[model samples]
Target chain A: MPIVQFTPFSSLVQPAFWHALTDLKIDVLRLSDEAIPVHGSYSAGRSVKDRESGAEIALGCNLSVGGESFSKEDKAPAHSVSATGVFKNYNTIEEFKAADKTALFAQVSDEIWKSITVDRSTAQLSRFLLITFADLKKYKYYYWFAFPAFAAKPAWEIQGDWKGASDEFSDTFLSAIESAQLASPRAFFLVRPKAGSDEPELAPVEEYDTFFANVNPVERTIAFLDPSAAPGNPGWPLRNLLTYLAALHPATSHRVLCWRDAERPAGAPFKSRFGVVSQGAGTGEAASTEKPAAVGWEKNVQGKLGPRVADLAPMMDPTRLADQAV
Target chain B: MHAIQQQYWAVRDYLSPVLKESKFKEHGRITPEEFVAAGDFLAYKFPVWSWEKGDASKARDYLPADKQYLVTRGVPCLRRATALAYTDADEDAERLLSFGDLSATGNEADEWVETHAGRAASTLDSAANAGNIDEIPDVDESSADDVADQVGRMHIQGGVGSLGEIPDMDEIPDMEEEGLEAGDDEATAAPKAAAPSSGVIEASEVEVAKGNLLQVRTYDVMITYDKYYQTPRIWLIGYDENRTPLMPAQIFQDVSADHAFKTVTIEAFPHSTSLQAASVHPCKHASVMKKVIERMNQGVLEEQRKAFGAGAVSPSTGKDKQKKWLFRRTSGPGKDAPALPAGEDDVEGMRVDFYLVVFLKFIASIVPTIEVDSTTAF
Candidate 1:
């Protein structure tokens, strides 16, 4: 019965992605500052428990971008959810700094909001923004990342204590969800128990209406690939998802499953969580009438609201290599 | 082995008659045929690793069109080699000292060596400095204030589903409205909550403390067949924590100190001309492979002896050993051995086919931190 805080996304840009960006900048967009579409992927969070305290540490969920990102390919590794994002590459550092970040954030949020309310697509819930100034001459890149999430009015609260998925659900039901996730990975999904059996049936978020047809509102279970490893906190993606769900069936209490799976060391048991969440009264009207404020700009290593810089001269510059070789 | 002795063996391997036997028992130097067989076995066993043809223009005619080299990308090198404790008494130091002789008799035949001389420390320092974002100038305050003022005036105006209209810049309010400062506070606060209360810490905390989840370096390791040396060569391309390509010196920090400047050198990879990677010199690969093959054959022979009685499989004769030492592929006609048991065939198959697996094991010692070899129980 505590306020549920979601873990923010930590941007992990692969070196190959930058290499691809460099290539793209040199060969394709010489002098132009275009907003390129890129793809980034995130999987279940890695649980890192503090040794001394034994309390779970809420580490940032990794939103990894790689060389294949530029192609906007949905080549997310198994068990990971891939989402499309916009990459705004500025020509100069001054331009990058002077750019209206607040406005940019709002624009992305508006698109996401429209997708939820108008397009009826929950896939856009994971859409993100990345702005960068590639100082190609110096091999230094200044960049900032934002995984926008609309704030919930009368913020969502946990209805009860969280329970492990394995403890709350049968093995058959968990495996069914696992199989569905593996079959076609999606960030958000809808799950409902079968008519005469304890096993659950899973469907993509787009089929929310049909999937939950004739079922009571309390029986509807909205699930997402939770990227937070912390005990109580969910991932940032769930915020927008709850907003979308609330818009459809406002002020209703719903069972939410934080679907977390370990894909490493093979056969690592699912460490997911099951809980109930509810929006405050009159949330439906507020959701439809007014767009909530959007917030989720990642902090730099210094924990400040600024862009991080990666000076790759030592790696990218041929002259630097030559100088080191001597 | 002494440098002169290694050089003599390397030269002799090139001049020696082609191995005619498939067992690969005598010397580590394997024929191209055996290399392909081993490569196939590697690909079959570990799907994460596969044979790549590389750039079409750079392909070699000798190897198969699709199997010119082996590659496993994005192998996470979680921590630097320096992060791990290494004492002078460790085996790594002894190995380095022993191989230190090879530095004198430079193998100019097939290997390229780049001497670090004394630049490693200074170069690494500068590379570390390059990563420090604090040195970069902050954004001008005046421009930031202007954006803040504009954000204050802006509000969500677009009606529901009105995505078509590209609203004027003034009309579209900046999105980072509410949670910007709160988000930073939450991120910074999360780590503090996990900090230990007591000064006495558990081993798990010590391990976790070593690596911040935020900083992780990755390497894409490639294995190419060195035709001239008749050995599998390893080339490494490393990336820093931010995914920027690591400089040669920065990469050197990840490599085992014993092998860094001694055996690893930066050169254009055989499969790609544009990218220069740090490759472990193949000058001594044949010698090392020969030693590994001999040890592996001995182990297999011991295992076979354990499974089947000593007399069941005839003990290899001196002539047979000499034959194996000289022409490994040519089977000795008089020394016919009994058939291997059902599961023992796997062990026999492994002798030649698992060359790369064994090669990877040996490479692990050189680059101890790069977790590329995922195979267990090999």
Candidate 2:
């Protein structure tokens, strides 16, 4: 048994999402405001097993974005973070090329190619993080665009002298990501992530009789058809449709309903990084350190308090719309 | 709930007519003429035998209790009148009654009617529904004299037509005379006519021809295993146009290796047409059931895999996966194809392919459930 809280891709008015969350024992983090789009949510138990050994695979990865929106004049900057890499089945670049459907394969045996590496864990870990969004639109952007771009980038291809690197990611990998295709008022899932893992394993469960059991297919199928709402109100209907998916899936705990208020703190790092912070001194103690930081004036600062650069990484589409026209 | 109930009633009503017109129409008719044609263009192609032979006691045993009661109590004279009408086709009744086939159970016939009615609402079946009955083959006066006579009496008895004096019996051909006429293809001369006093030329006969035309016969048969308590006993009554009784019929044959059930055919009366001849049921094995279950599981698994951020396994199932793979691979040579530039170092594409195959195979192993076949041939 695991806990999952479903967040809509847009709004959280859907009773289905709340019902699903309550059943899963995951506190519903209502994405009530207009900011975050609520898509769908669910949590369940899952085991990532090694292909050869049939044993659980231990893996870790972080998801991040590189671009942000600006008002009048702001320069877009490139960003990157470096981390240590472990080659589990370390093989020469040649061995990788001949292997069909392998997680990693060699393209060439040159010095520049030696620096490049591709692994299933790298892409998969990133995907596990993106499905946590409650909004379908956001989830769509992550799956349809961002994940493909990451997969398309050549696994850190290196040029002469190991300086210039070509981005080689495959769009095919994004096809593997799943969507919470349920839209109902009373549905929930048990999300149990593997031990020592941040991601919750998701398993969808619907209430039928007093017994907690797997839902009959009729109800489950309806949820998948429209995961936001149960075809009542057309406005933000996706929220209601996705509510049915809160049960029995992986990454169920990641579901968050948008909770936006005029005075509420921003949820993501990107929101605060780009938005101006207020110094209202509501708690007096923090004010004692600064010369009483400006309070209401901070709201006027443009682009700093809203969605920031890192949040967009999972949703970035480098191909400008105007470029497509050409 | 009301709509469902209404649908059920409609099914019941439609079935009643199909069973009557198709299975029991020729029951009490005197003519050896084909009752209902399978196709209008093929009119003489398929003959429909009647189910009744006109004897009250015999017809009583073949009809269901309720129907017998209706004929006896609701319209008392119908049984005897129909019996007289069936005199010309008594042999047909005897032939139809002998080939007993249990597969032709009235209940199954009713169910077929119900299923057909239920499917009639679908857009695909609307054409078939509209084409029914406004389109039945016509029966002329010359082809249906006995049926015409029987129905005429019935209408008059029910007070449905103007009452008139019964015509003379000598004028109309009796069973013996009709049998002589049936054997003689070429007539030497016109037979002498009798005065219209033997119930042969009643105005009721005209009304029966113009309206109240009898098209089919229906028997309400109730087969019970219990034998005691004769009061309100179960009866299987057969009837012709004039409510004549029909004899029981049965046929048995063997065919096919895989299908072990016997092919039992039974002829219906008057028209002397053979009905459906087939097995009642064919058993299935446990292995077949297991395969069906597996297919269902695979389908559900494939659906779940299509969710967002679902990176664990391939979401697609069945032919769609193959179609997609072929389409993507053949789009172009280098377009979107994963490739390494010349002079590149060790690129590990092999490992990626390995994991992808393992994941695909894992998902493909489970089978999805398919709908079961419930119909039995008869």
Candidate 3:
């Protein structure tokens, strides 16, 4: 069995997001360093295949935020799953650099654990944290993104080679899943055989017990909108989902379906994958009782865990605009 | 047979509403009906371009509910206009200055010159003409001094402030120690301590030197029918390398220097809700389209002469035929005749349906770096 390694989420902060942040800082958050809630979104990953080698190249999962991120009333774009995040805007660069990131990570991990075990909310699985210092005068920003995922005591392992959904399921079954996903996009769901029929149907994760009723635990299949394009691995969101699942049915094996539909060429069928995964004994109980250690601060372009800078002077500074207009 | 067919089309076109009732042939302006026909033709030829129903509140009642405007998003601009080679700068500068003079004087006789010269200047001038004496002094002095001073201040503060602030460096090690004391997993703590110390110091330095050189910007270019101008208008929205929206001034670097401020102005897009974008002024679009249509007509006439002899379709007694002949003679030389593909020329001359296709070709010069039209060969 291959040790399942999940691809980490990469931050894609749209230019509109920065412009909106600048507006927010000036109009609403002047001199305030409070953490405000922001919204972001992620869709199923598109696989970039090596033309010659035919090997699937993992374009790291992207969590993107845009101009609408500041508006709590706004929803994610069509066919994407929304994520909630805490945005901490420091008053100065010194404050941003000197802040305790490790403690910040721990706090977020604790909140996520509580959401899963206490509140039983499935959406909390994709919560993230962002810290920033916006230099409005220069139109430059210094920021870091952290997508925390619990490190399972004994990590989940794949029991067999993953097969494409097209090869594993009939056309009718795949179409049913597609319709369900289109009707309501969710991060996680359960795929069960419809009662009195061999066809498959998707149900929300909250209905886990009723969804899998009278079915064997080994045959039960859990599905998620996978944001990883890598053939051998799933995305980071699946880590905490597995933790939530283990808490529900401790120390059990279940089939996992990684639903990837976004990146396919026009007219091509969905390219989802399915495999078997099992957790270690009593791992679910520990996750429910104790806060698990987490790891997912995004690495910069240099492959180092440091803040990225966006020098937007050319695009945001009024003085620069005046000069260009002349 | 060809001459007879050409004569029949010439007669039909004379009676056609586009020519008889509308001013499309004479003034280049089209009626709303003609605009819809052109839009449909453009959408059919280029699937990349599709009609979109924009914000419902902003939708115009004149256009169809579903086909309010045409849009194509994420058009990759691989290089800035400044990056292109401007080999014909002198000719373009002279032509562009003449255009400015003509517009200032309000002379429509040189209207065709504005169309031809505008296209040539957009292609040849690119952004290098920004260095022309007429436009360079204020921009160079203001931007160069301001940018240099700002860059210097940023380096001094960013470099010295981070290094001099001892607590910043001290805090990383302290956090590592705390993680170890708390029995934190090695998976999380190892990456943090390994990078931030040395990486942060080096990253700031590297960012200062090579930031602009590596990044490429993208543009979302849209075309909509202008009711007042009765011509197709183009709008542009730019994004930086990180997919962040570019400021109005920043977008100037991607527009051809000759057209940037003179022909392209910031205006609220009609289809969008309060979204201000840079749009190519449609004041000259009708003239350019008129010139293009005349050129297409000349191509068909040239083919008619080659196949059926010059005397075969001589101007008849009708006043319309004589007027058309006189207009063609005075329009200009056949040197710039459109290179229509062999055997594909329509006997009735270029259809108004192909209006947007030719319009895009004229616009490609103004936004030389944007690769929106390359996929659809005219």
Candidate 4:
């Protein structure tokens, strides 16, 4: 009998509820500190009553988007606005919106632009799981965002701590996990950020386009169930091997044992799973002659994990995974 | 019914004194009818010649319904046997006397006095006593007074093996010897010693509640534990549950003042529909006591018949046998009754831990709280 030990499910499972991202890879890259010139002042605008007309006026507006100033146009219109003096004052949308404007139309235009451009970088990952520093030190496990199972829209593009290096929005994912309505708990994958020898590449402030297209295929290992992410849609595609395993009789005799601590080889891996291999010089019973039933629900060698490896095989299948999701 | 009743009463009256003194009947619930019924039931349950054919089924079918009801009622009895065996006064005197070894001392003195008295009475035995070798010992009344005085002294000191060793016997002083010679000795006469009182059960209202097929009511009686608690007390309590109270007017009896009176309350729920009645004892002690009483009743039955007759039979004994057999043989009770049909090859028995299931189901309800006494300044 394999000794099957388990960490208290309460501790392990409860943390999993909040820390789904523990297994996913997410990077919250911050914009670099280089100077970028923008032509217009950024602004927030709300409609107010015109003092003379008594009609609603979208007032106090400037530029909406912020970026570096391009070369000046040679031919200027009769009445052109010069934001040069106000560059420092209107670097952000809020600063620009506070500026007095000649026409209500300026504020209205700023409001429309502000509503249109969503900050995709800071957009919340569908689900995130947090991990304690202890867990990081104990298990050198990595998390990566991928749609390995599904190839249409992706569920998550990044994982790990999404908080910028400064830990600006640490509570963002935590609150989402608590309040968001989720289908399956396994909807998100979390991974650690890979450190490189090269110093980080810092880019000057500029308008950022969707960077998902720039993502490498190597990163798409774990499948995400959510469809909104591009390429992966509907649900994850099932792996043939997992499907084949699921097709076998529930009490299949074939044993595929998984080992912990891959470092030192202990007992016969397949032998333990197969129930045929014996330990030592003819001392213990051989697995083959015994004709044991499937090891799906059997104990591990040192014995303590739950729901035998074989039992989990069926669950590994994408089809079954979706079906069994809570 | 009257013959059965008469047989029952005859057995009840004969065994009542004994049954009333039993540990099971301490609360005095065992009525004469019920006690007789118990005996009647046992006789039928395990009949003498039925051993060869004895099986659980036959045993279950043997008991008469009425007897089963009565016996089941007296479920919880007194704590100990000696409580019922000896009355309060007797037990106290016995305790005080035991401390002093009066049985040994007093008996020796009694024998001595009896011999002397006999000899004195036989003085008129004449010729044989007057014979030469058999010359009469000197009959000085004062010398007799010395022996009497010594006996009296011994009784006062609580010494063993002497008449004076008795606790109260010394109070009699001495009227032996000189007093017998003078014939005017009224002063030292022994005071009238009182007899140990018997238990007198009082009549009380017996409430019976019928629910669907069953009738149950709670019966309460003051338990006196002066003498010795035992099976008869429990049996009597069981008997009271089934029928009307035998004596309802005055329930308390001074078996002994050493025994404090505590009222015992037990509920008896009997099913008129169930030819097989079942009773619930408050504790396992009472249940075991009931079983023991039933077994003892079965053992002494033949002797009991000579001494007390059919009424000495235990009511539950017959019913238990019948219920067991009935359940075993025909899958229990009515033919149409819902039951797991037994197959011809099913010898091992249709298995279900029914009792365990019932126990598990209700275990949550009466889950006992560990009562930690917080009163002590800990």
Q: List the TM values for chain B, per candidate.
A: 0.56, 0.16, 0.54, 0.17
Q: Give the alpha carbon lDDT tens digit for every residue of B8-83 in model 1.
A: 6447745755444553555566667778878886665454476776667778766789888887655655445543
Task: Name the candidate, 2 or 3, with the larger TM-score value.
Answer: 3
Q: What is the interface RMSD of candidate 3, in Å?
A: 15.8
| Alpha-carbon TM-score of each model against the true structure | 0.68, 0.13, 0.59, 0.13
- In model 4, the Cα lDDT at residue B370 comes to 7
Candidate with the larger TM-score of 1 and 2: 1
User: Where is model 4 more than 4 Å wrong at Cα?
Assistant: A1-326, B1-67, B70-249, B254-263, B266-378
True contacts kept of 4: 0.00
Q: Rank order by lDDT, top first?
A: 1, 3, 4, 2
Candidate lDDT values, in order: 0.62, 0.18, 0.62, 0.20
lDDT digits (tens) for residues A204-262 of candidate 4: 11111222124243321221112110111111111211122122211111121111111
Best by TM-score: 1
Q: Is candidate 1 or candidate 4 better by DockQ?
A: 1
Off-target runs (Cα >4 Å) in candidate 3 are A47-60, A196-198, A217-219, A262-266, A280-287, A322-326, B1-378
What's the residue-level lDDT of B209 in candidate 1?
32
* DockQ scores of the candidates: 0.08, 0.00, 0.07, 0.00
In Å, residue A184's CA in model 1 sits off its true spot by 4.2
Error of 1 at B271 (Å): 6.2
Error of 2 at B123 (Å): 14
Q: What TM-score does chain A of each model score against the native chain A?
A: 0.92, 0.16, 0.92, 0.14
Worst ten in a row by lDDT for model 1 chain B? B95-104
